[model samples]
Target chain A: AQSVAQPEDQVNVAEGNPLTVKCTYSVSGNPYLFWYVQYPNRGLQFLLKYITGDNLVKGSYGFEAEFNKSQTSFHLKKPSALVSDSALYFCAVRALGGSSNTGKLIFGQGTTLQVKP
Target chain B: EAGVTQSPTHLIKTRGQQATLRCSPISGHTSVYWYQQALGLGLQFLLWYDEGEERNRGNFPPRFSGRQFPNYSSELNVNALELEDSALYLCASRMTGSHNEQFFGPGTRLTVL
Candidate 1:
């Protein structure tokens, strides 16, 4: 089984400050980790993914995530937080091996990030 | 190229009724995925269709079903709708062997009365 855990329901950061949203996962095999952002009333937008190689993956909107295999974590990060970045973030995982070639993702409960000006 | 697209941006249905949501994959894409985003539940995988075949489904009941067309479009049909079924239904598409990075549509807001 594959699962993702976003320990924080909400994270607050000041504008211009760095922000991090924590995510951890449990999977049977090598994990394909992803980060997605959802604005109000909109669908999820892909942010970044860690398929293989490179522990640090940069994505759209000045966002990035670091994949830690030992920690089983893929945490979203931003060098400088902006008010526009305030939205819901989700961490998702998919197993790379086994009979699971369906490409179905298991998403976390989501973390709401609030960047205050 | 155009991103994934979904139809009927908003839908309303009463309990016991059925709701049909549609999706069109991106050009050259061969897979479609459906997800349900309900309050408190976040996003739950609903179905995965690749090459006009149902490759995988989540733990949803039989009432939640869908099919993919020859052109790689897809439709999600939810039978016996309940109030709890009211949520945003999101559709995503991906190219085969594309590292499983899916592009999502704006999604349909389904409100079950």
Candidate 2:
């Protein structure tokens, strides 16, 4: 079965410092990875996705993720952390072929990013 | 273009009651997906519909069901609701493509007493 794991329950980062929210995935075939952020009482907002191409994929709000094939990891990153960037981050994976064609995503237990000023 | 939209931003029901949630997909989107965001379960895929057909579903019970309309709008019906069913129900839509990303709506908060 396809699955996503976000090792951290919460990541604390100081303002102006870089932040990294870790994510790892398991899938039978090639994986389409995605990142989404949710704020208090709001729905999830798409951050970025790794379908194909460059290992590093940039997304909304100055955030980017590196898709490492060998490591089976797609880590969300930001060079400078801001208080507004704090939110719940989720990693999801969809298998490329076979019965997984339904496009249903397997999501990880979310990680909360807390950026302190 | 308008994004995915869901109605009844909040719904409250008692156990054993039935609850209905509605969603409107983005224009031109042919696929609709429903997910449940519970307290600790993360996000679980509930159903997937494409071209007015039920393409697939997750490991949820039969009480959780839904259908898509000809215009691509959809409705989720939960029968025999339980306290565990209290959650944020999210609706998402995507164009008919393997690589396209899904857009989400402001989910409905369902509370079961």
Candidate 3:
């Protein structure tokens, strides 16, 4: 089955410091990985996705993620953390081939990032 | 372009009652997907609709069903709602094609008492 795992339930970082939110996935074939952030009482906002191109993918709000095929990991990274960046982050994966080409995403449990001022 | 939109931003219902949630996909988008985000269950796909047809569904029960209209908008109906059914129901949309990412709506907060 296709699945995503965000090992950390919470991550803490100081403002202006670099932050990394780890994610690893399992799927039957090549995977489509995505990162999304959700604020309290709001829907998820798309951050970035790795389809088939360059491994380093950049997205909205100064966020980026690195796709490592060997390790099956796509970790979200930010050069500098901000208080506004503190939110619930989710890692999702969708399989590319076979019967799992339904385009439905399998999401991780989510990670909460706390950026201290 | 306008993004996906959902109705009844917040809903409160009692156990055994039914709930209906609606969604309008972004213009020119033909695929609409529904997901449930319960407290414990992170985010699970509920149903997928494209071009007025039900394309796929998740591991949910028959009580959890939905349909897509001719305009490509959709509605999800949950029968015999239980306390566990209380969750944030999210609606997402994408163009009918490969390698397309879905855009989500604000979501409907359904509370079952």
Candidate 4:
């Protein structure tokens, strides 16, 4: 079985400061990890993903994540925070096994990050 | 190209009633996925369809059912709905080969009273 965990329910940061939102996963085979952001009344938007190589993957909106196999973590990072970046973030995972996807995305509870100016 | 689109931006149904939500995948995309996001809760996987077939499903009950049409459009049907069924239903779509980059719709707000 595959699972994801976002240990923190919320995170706070000041605008212009660096920020990080942690995520961890557990899956049988190689994991396909993803990060998504959701704004009030808006749909969940894809931020980035970690399918294979390149431990550090850059994504939309100056966001990036580092995949650590030994730590079993894929944490989202931003060089500098912005008030607009404040939103609910979710971590997800799917395993690749056979012809089709091995399983559905097991999502984390999500973290509400508040970035103040 | 247009992204995923869902019908009935908002819906309200009493307990035990049925609710049906529709979704249209991006042009040329052949896979659709359904997820339920309850207020204060994260995305809960519901079902997945590819090439007009049910490729996989989550741990949700049988009441949470759906179907995919030949054109890659889909419908999610919730039977015997209860008050706890209130949540936002998201529909996402992607090309068969590139399932990871799924595009999502604005979502349908389903309220079971």
- Model 4 spans > 4 angstroms off: A98-100
Tens digits of per-residue lDDT for model 4 on A12-112? 99999999999999887788889999998878899999989899999999999999999999999999999999999998887777643534677899999
Please report how far candidate 2 places residue A115 from its true position, in Å.
0.4
In model 2, state the lDDT of residue A65. 99
| Steric overlap count per candidate | 0, 0, 0, 0
lDDT string for model 2 (A1-117, tens) is 678999999999999999999999989988999999999988889999999999999999999999999999999999999999989999999887877777898899999999999
Per-residue C-alpha lDDT of model 4 across residues B28-101, encoded as one tens digit per residue:
98889999999776788899999999988977899999999999899999999998899999998877664357
Instruction: For each candidate in the order shown, give its overall lDDT on alpha carbons.
Output: 0.93, 0.95, 0.94, 0.90
lDDT of 1 at A27: 89
Q: What TM-score number comes out for model 2?
A: 0.99
lDDT of 1 by residue, A6-104 (tens): 999999999999999999999887889999999998888999999999999999999999999999999999999999999999999988776865589
Q: Measured by TM-score, how close is model 4 to the native structure?
A: 0.95
Query: Cα deviation of B51 in candidate 3 (Å)?
Result: 1.0
- The candidate, 1 or 3, that scores higher on lDDT is 3
Candidate 1 local lDDT, residue B63: 100
Off by over 4 Å in 2: none
Residue A11 lDDT in model 4? 96
Winner by DockQ = 1
> Per-residue CA lDDT of candidate 3, range A1-116, in tens?
67899999999999999999999999998899999999999988899889998999999999999999999999999999999999999999989787878879899999999999
lDDT (10s digit) by residue, model 2, range B62-88 = 999999999999999999999999999
DockQ for candidate 3: 0.85
